[model samples]
Target chain A: MKELSLNILDITENSVKAGAALTQILIDEDASTLLLTIADNGSGMTKEVLQGVTDPFYTTRTTRSVGMGLPLLKLAAEQTDGWMKVESIHISDDPENHGTKVEALFHKDHIDFTPLGDVVSTLLTLIQGHPDTDFLFRHSIRGGEKEVEVHMDTRELREALDDVPLNEYEVIKWIEEYLNEQYNGPEDAEE
Target chain B: MKSLAELQKIKANMKQRIVLREGSGDIRVVVGMATCGIAAGARPVLNELVKDVSEEGLSEKVTVSQTGCIGICQYEPVVEVFEAGKEKVTYVKMTAEKAKEIVEKHLKGGQVVEEYTIGAYQS
Candidate 1:
């Protein structure tokens, strides 16, 4: 993907398809390094499934033969002189605690590093497409006068929404402005 | 800065509209967003569809969502439209511009843009 946000969207789709009720997308970045973590409370994979996940030929899907999400993400990370890792515990193995966590670290100073594009749009798309599922998004930047963070949890929104759906047009629009305002800061928004 | 408090105001406002239209949308716009599709640029197409649908006031009648691969990787950025009483139309290699045109002509004007369909590209 041209933007790392696209990769984030693609990987998170896997979690949704796996029937994850809650997914957490966390990002931590500094001047030289960026870390992205997508953890989902979904039906985790078997050992064999985990082993083949990074292979472009391996896929749990019946629609097509190839699964390119993990492979492409791995390439993107490694090309930036960084790494990617996956940890999972299948439901068959441990029903109480079964989920998947994918972490990709990229050295932002490297020439091959991909930009984290409009992530607000990515989060909105996720909410719009899968309104029933919940998402927790937190993005933090470390190299500033003070650490800055942008946070959102659907669990909290769901409580506030009551019977209204999260994908309601006004809800989505409000979220877009909310996130953009956060990213831009109140002072910048005033300008 | 925007806050969650404002979402409350929106929730209150949307409740009236929701009660007026209780059922789901009659048409569905599904954008393919698998690896091939994203790498080929489906995000912009999706954003355009969502923006256009809302701006054109077609939100009540149409729903724009996303899906995984349709097993046609060659046609990287594909879009499928489903109407209540019509055949599914697949548009391939779509861009944001084309998405806007589709929204205006096919969605708003009730006339399909035949040249953008998969059949036109193949034959």
Candidate 2:
């Protein structure tokens, strides 16, 4: 993926395929570092599967023999002098709490760091593709003494929307504007 | 400063417009979004479909979604369209421009863009 947001979208698709009721995409960025954590309450992988996940040849899908999602993400992180880690608890091992968490740290100062581009569009695509699943997205940037955050939880929207689908054209448009507004902050009317 | 409170307003408005419409459409547009597809630029194609469908006011008559790998890695970024009484049309090696044309011609105009289909690409 050219952009980190595309990587985020590709990885989250796996979570949705695993039947995750909730997926969380969290990003914490400073001047020099960017940390991405994607957690999902889906059917987790076995120890063997987890161990082989970073390998480009490992995949659970019958259609394709190779899975590039995790491997590409690990490559993207390592190229920036950073690392990627994945942890999972299989459904058979712990039925009550089973899921996967992928965390990657990227040094933004490195020359090979991939930019996080058009994340708002990525989030909208996820929601539109899987209306039944819920997503919690939080992105925070720390600069000096100030911290700016953009947060959204689909669960809360579901409660407020009642029967209206989260992927409804109007609702998705509202969400896009909502996220954009947060990023832009309070616009100056006078200027 | 946009808040969840605005969702209530949308809910009220949507309910009146779509009182009993559960599943929106009879036509399904499925985009392959696997690693191969993403690497080959499926995201833009998917976005183009959604944007055009909504803008054309075909939201209620069509549904655009995504699927995993279909074992055709060579033909990444594939799109399949399914209608009520017609055969599924698979479009391969799709770009954003091609997707827009498909929406306007096949979807809105009710005629398949045969040159973009898998049959043309394969044969």
Candidate 3:
């Protein structure tokens, strides 16, 4: 994907297809590196599937032949002198044990790394598209010695709604504003 | 930032339409969103469908959704329309503009646009 947020959207779609009730996305950036992590409480992949996830030619979808989501992410990380990892375990009896976590680390200063696209829109799209699934997003950025973090939890928003549907137009607009306020605090407002 | 009261106002105004849309709809519009589809620019197509459907007040009759892939990488950015008691119509190499046209002719006018369909492209 041209933008990191698009890649996030693609991978989270995979989590939804896997029957995940909750997906957590985290983006942490510092002076030296940027880390992206997506974890899901879904039907975990088998050991074999996990091993081939980074291969561009291997895809679980029968539609078309190639799966570029993970492979492209891995390539992006590697191009920046970084790496990616995937961990999954299947234990039906234990909900915690049955899930997948994917983490990709990239050198922040590398020219090859793509910019994070409209992340606020990406989050809203996911929330509106899949109302039943809960999502948690955290963005933390550290420049020099100062660090700031912003977090959003859909479960909490759901509780505040008193059964109002999340996909309502007004709710979506509110979410956009909420993300903007949280992501761009007064101290580091984007111009 | 706007308060929840604003949302409540929208909710009250839209409650009836929302209920009808969610209760039943026979028409389904599905956009392919796999790796190939995304690379071929399916996001805009999907967004256009959702926006037009709601704006045109066709939400009560047509539902828009996304799918993984349609097994046609060559036809990336494909969209299929399914209506009750009618054959499914598949549109190939879709764009936001074409999606809008589809919403107008196929979904609203009840006449499929032959030029946009995959069958037309093949022939």
Candidate 4:
């Protein structure tokens, strides 16, 4: 759970720095299942780049960039008694079609993505910091046969945040709402 | 909480004012947000710029933006300012404190912090 939150924060930072115009996040957690994905329309990587990114030794540079975040995410997803996959395509040729997609799925093994909450905090942090960029966050949790999407009204938390840019204090509060939506929503909010 | 949709209002307002500000030659605050920039904490600087500028009602005359790596990673998160018909000034190793100084000393008083600029390093 804690690992997932850190993964999200790290991935989003990569998306922003990748020169993405828009970044998308989809997190669906139900009592029995959890599916998470982060996608970006940034400078896509080539097949070579994609193959290398997941490598622990892979990095953007030899200095300052440890390049651990994405790979760590891959690890958390795959090790979480679930499934994980990553894909990317270079958009330089057809810029419109270029994008990188990363996914992590957790099933009933109860790997627990409940801790280290603050998805909204995580998402909102990226959005607020990069006003020049656009981001979409879609989250859902399972019910019976349906998935309930907990729509948070926390975007307005932007104004109250005042001069702070996703500070730890504010981020903690935002995470609370995120946890509620994922773990505390109606039995079947998706339907 | 604000709706993501309401960001339209911000955009709409920026659109309407962009032309006026450009024509009128307002002070533009440019933050270095390249990979080096964000990793160096450009996010907080950007937020401070947005919030302070708005709170001070300086939004009409000052605008904030993000840019990619400037190859000057050692000096990031840098901020540069371009005023009408003036030489560009780049501030290196900028924190919230330095950002505010740029606002008060340069943006408002029309005087560059010659000591804190990239030129300072070149010298």
Fnat of all models, as shown? 0.62, 0.74, 0.16, 0.00
lDDT of 4 by residue, B1-123 (tens): 323344444444444445654544367778765445655666557656655766566756776765656668789879988777777788998888777777777877778888889888888
- What Cα-based lDDT does every candidate model obtain? 0.90, 0.92, 0.82, 0.64
Q: In model 4, which runs have C-alpha deviations exceeding 4 angstroms?
A: A1-22, A27-36, A41-43, A54-85, A89-98, A104-134, A139-191, B1-25, B118-123
Better of 3 and 4 by DockQ: 3
In order, the TM-score of chain B in each prediction is 0.95, 0.91, 0.91, 0.76
Query: For every candidate structure, what is the RMSD over all alpha carbons to the true structure, in angstroms?
Result: 1.7, 2.0, 3.5, 8.6
Model 1 interface CAPRI class:
medium
Q: How accurate is candidate 4 locally (lDDT)?
A: 0.64
Badly placed stretches (over 4 Å) of model 3 are: A62-65, A92-96, A144-150, A181-191, B2-14
Per-residue lDDT of candidate 2, residues B1-123 (tens digit) = 576889999999999778656676999999998888988899889988999998998888889998888778799899999999999999999999999999999999999999999999889
Those runs of model 2 whose alpha carbons end farther than 4 Å from true positions after fitting are A144-147, A186-191, B20-24
**Clashing residue pairs in candidate 1, if any?**
none
lDDT of 2 by residue, A25-125 (tens): 99999989999999999999999999999999998877657778999999999999999999999999999999999999999989999999999999998
Model 1 chain A: lowest-lDDT 10 consecutive positions: A182-191
Ranking of all predicted structures according to DockQ, beginning with the best and ending with the worst: 1, 2, 3, 4
Model 1 lDDT per residue over A54-93, tens place = 9999988887688899999999999999999999989899
